[model samples]
Target: MSSTLQLVGMGVLAIIALWVLLQLVGIVFSIVSTIVSFLVSLLLLAIIAVLVYFAFTALT
Candidate 1:
């Protein structure tokens, strides 16, 4: 009975550890995704601004 109880306790602890690790990894990935998205948007806006400026210059 003691051996069985110890096995069960170890299993529970392992599951909890895995859950915490996955949560941390998910959070890190989410932060990286947000940063990458912001950078991409900023780059696109800069490109569009340059195009508009040149277009207006041509018309003038």
Candidate 2:
């Protein structure tokens, strides 16, 4: 009976550990995606600024 209880406890612990690991992975993925999106936005803004500057100079 004790052995059966021990087995059940171990299985529960394993499941909890897996859940925590998946949560951590999800958090990391979100952080990475956010950073990538920010960088892309910055790059696009810079390109637009440069184009506007060129257009203004051409007009002048």
Candidate 3:
């Protein structure tokens, strides 16, 4: 009966460890996604600025 109890405790510990690891990985991915989104927005703004500059020069 004591050996069975030991096995149950070990199983619970292993499950907790896996859960913590998955949570850490999720956090890292979220941060990377945010950075990529910001970079994309910056690129779009740069393109729009270039187009506007050319249009203004043509009108003059």
Candidate 1: 10-residue stretch with minimal lDDT = 1-10
Clash count for candidate 2 is 0
Give each model's whole-structure lDDT.
Answer: 1.00, 1.00, 0.99
Candidate scoring better on TM-score of 2 and 3: 2
In the range 1-60, model 2's lDDT, one tens digit per residue, is 999999999999999999999999999999999999999999999999999999999999
Mind giving the per-residue lDDT tens digits that candidate 1 earns over 2-58? 999999999999999999999999999999999999999999999999999999999
Pick by TM-score: 1 or 2, better one: 1
**Best-performing candidate as measured by TM-score:** 1
Model 3: per-residue Cα lDDT at residue 5: 94
Quote each prediction's TM-score.
0.84, 0.83, 0.80
Candidate 3: misplaced stretches above 4 Å? none
